[model samples]
Target: MAGEVRAQGAVKSGQLDFPRPLTTVDVVIFSILDDKLQVLLVQRPAGEGEPFPLSLALPGGFVDIARDRDLAACAARKLKEKTGVTSPYLEQLGSWGSASRDPRGWSATHAYFALILADASTLTSDARWLPIRDGKLREKLAFDHGEILASAIQRLRNKVEYTSLPAYLMPAEFTLPDLQRVYEIVLDRPLEKSAFRTRILSADMIEPVAKMRRGPNRPAQLYRLKKNSEPVYFVRTFNPPE
Candidate 1:
C-alpha cells in the first residue's frame, strides 16, 4: 500500500530514497545590556565525539517534527528554551546549508533573529550575553554561527536606519531619550535628537503611557509600543548627525 511506505529511507512515488541532511533551527537573540548591543550565546557541552564541544554557539537544536509546526515555531521554541522569554520581534533572517558546515553530517539551519529587553528574560546557566563590538564578535563561534551572526547584525543595523526595529530592545515603559539611546546603541552613531524625536513620534508606533520617568533634570513622559504594533518604516534612512 502507498501509505505503508513508512520505513526510513523508503521510496515512495516521487520521494528520494537517499538519507536526508541534518535539519535544525537557530536563533540569534539580541538585546541591549550594559549600554551595549549584546547577543545571547550558549556553550556546547563537552563530550567525546561531540562536534564543537565547549564552544559557544547560537541557541538551537534539531527540529522536532512532532512538536514544531513550522520553521517559525521551531525558532520560537528554541529561543524560549534558551532565554525563557518569548520576544515579540522575532524575524526570519535566512537559511544556511552546506556539507562542510557541520562535522557530523550535511546540515541546514533556518536562522531567525529576535530582539528583546535584556532584563525581561532569565537565561540558563550555560547561556550568557556577549557584547557585539564594531559589528563583529571577538571570539569565534562554533560551526557557521559566526557568519550567521554577522549577517543578523548587518540586517538589524540596516533595518534600524529605516524601520522602528530598535523599539523591541526597549523596556515596557521608557522616555523618548531612552528610546533614542537604544537606537544609537544599535546603529553605532549619534542621531540628531530633534529629528529622531520627530520621526519616532510621527510614526505612531508608540503611545504615551500614564507614567513618567523621573530623572535628574525633570520628569520625562513615558511611552510604550502601541498594542499589536508593527515596526514602522520611514520614508528615508536616518542620516548621521552633521
Candidate 2:
C-alpha cells in the first residue's frame, strides 16, 4: 500500500526518471583585469564532430553525486580539474536541459556561471580569456554554448542596474569610480560620471569599509555592499508593453 502511494506521489510530482539521461554542467566564468572584461575558455581537443580541434569553451562536466547535489560546487570542481582555477563566485545561473541543446544522444547539460578573480595569466593550460567581443571566436562548441553565451551577456547587463552584485567581481575594498568603470565595461558604454555616482550612492546598497585605496592621483575611500544585502538586489516591477 505504501509503495503504491509513493508511485502515485511520483506521478503527481513528475519525479520519475524513466530513461537515463546524460547530465552535465557548463559554466561561463567571468573576470576583469588590466581594464578589460575577459572570460575563461578551455580548448577542445581533436574529437568526433567538434568544429575547432583547439578552440575555446567554458569548463563543465557531468554532476558527481559524491560531491553533493550542490550544482555550483559541481561546476567549481569540474573547472578546477579542467582549468586549474577555483573561483570565489560560482553560481547556478539556470538550468538548460532541453533535448535539442545537445547533439549527443539523450544528454543534456546544466549551465552555471562563475565570476573569477583577476590575474588569470597563470591559466595557461589551454585555458584563457578571449575578449567577449573577440572576432576570432568562430569555434563550434559541444552544446548550445553560443546561444547560452548570448543570454548570459544580457542577464549580466540587466542585473547590473538593479543589483550591486557586480561588486563580487571586485575586491573587498573599491572606490565609486572603480565600481562605475566596471559598470561601463559590462554595459559597453560611457556612463556619465556624475549621474552614475549619484544613482549608485543614493541606492544605499553599499557601506564604507575601514580601508582606503591609495591611487596614483589621490587616496580614495573604499566601500563594500551593505549587510542587509537584499536592498542591493531590488528588482523593480515591470509590465510587458501593451
Candidate 3:
C-alpha cells in the first residue's frame, strides 16, 4: 500500500514515475520558567536571504530515510544534534508544505512539539530558551517557524485544560502549588488554589508520594503522575476562579 511504502521510506523498484517530495522534520521545544512559557531556538549558520540566517530558529533537520526508523527518530536525532537535549514528551504536530516553503526543491515537513524542563546546562551550545508573548517569537524564529510555534502553543493551552499533558512539563516530584503555577502559566490565567486542587484530586491525575519538599515556610507534600494515567478530554474546561 502507499501508506506502507511511505512508512518504510521505500519503493519496490527504487524508482518512481513522479518526483517525491523531500521529507524533513521540525521540532518546537517548549518549557516554563519564572511563570513564562518559553521555547528553545538555535542560531542558524550564515546564508543569503534566509529568514533566520545567523539568527535563531527551531531545532530541526532532514530525515535520513536510509538510517532513521521513522519521522520521530529523525526529529529526536535532529533535536539532540542541534540542541543537545531530549524531551520528556514529544508528539507530532502535523505536516506542512508550501510550494515556496523551501528553496532547495519541493519539500514537505512533519512538525513535532515537545515539553522539557528549563535548564540551560542541559542544552547544547548556541541553543537558548526565549519567552513567548504578544507575538514576540514570530519576529525571531524564521521560515514559517513562527506559524508552527503558534500552533504548538495553542495546542498546549487547549490540551492542558482537559488533559494531563502538563505532567510532561513537571518534575518527577512536585507540590500542588508547583503544578498550579505550570497550569497558570500555560493557561495564561490564575486559578483558584482550592478549586484547582480539588479538580486535580478528583480526576486522579496524580498520586502523593511519601516524601515532602523542605522549604522556607512549610513542608510541601510531593506528588507525581498516577501510574497508567493516560490523558483524557474532560467534559468541560478547567477554569478556576481568579
Task: Write candidate 1's Cα lDDT for 1-242 as tens digits.
Answer: 22332343336566676556789999999999999999999998899998999999999999999999999999999889888887558999999999789987778999999998879898899999999998788989999999999999999999999999988888888899999999988889888999999999999889999888887888999999898768899999977433
Task: Please give the CA lDDT of all the candidate structures.
Answer: 0.90, 0.67, 0.78
**Better candidate by TM-score, 1 or 3:** 1
By descending TM-score, how would the candidates be arranged?
A: 1, 3, 2
By lDDT, highest first, what's the ranking?
1, 3, 2
Worst 10 residues of 1 by lDDT: 1-10
Give per-residue CA lDDT, model 2, range 82-168, as digits (tens). 556675566667777764665544567777776666653256577767666531235555567777676677677667766666776
lDDT of 3: 0.78
Q: Which model is ahead, 2 or 3, in terms of lDDT? A: 3
Candidate 3 per-residue lDDT over residues 54-140, each given as its tens digit: 767788877888979999888888776755666457889998887567765557889999887775327778777888875246454
Candidate 2: worst-modelled 10 consecutive residues by lDDT: 233-242
Error of 1 at 236 (Å): 0.4
Model 2: lDDT to the true structure: 0.67
Candidate 3: residue pairs that collide: none
Once fitted onto the true fold, the runs of candidate 2 whose alpha carbons sit more than 4 angstroms away are: 1-17, 47-53, 80-87, 98-100, 120-124, 134-140, 210-212, 216-218, 227-231, 234-242
Deviation from native of the Cα of residue 135 in model 3, angstroms: 6.7
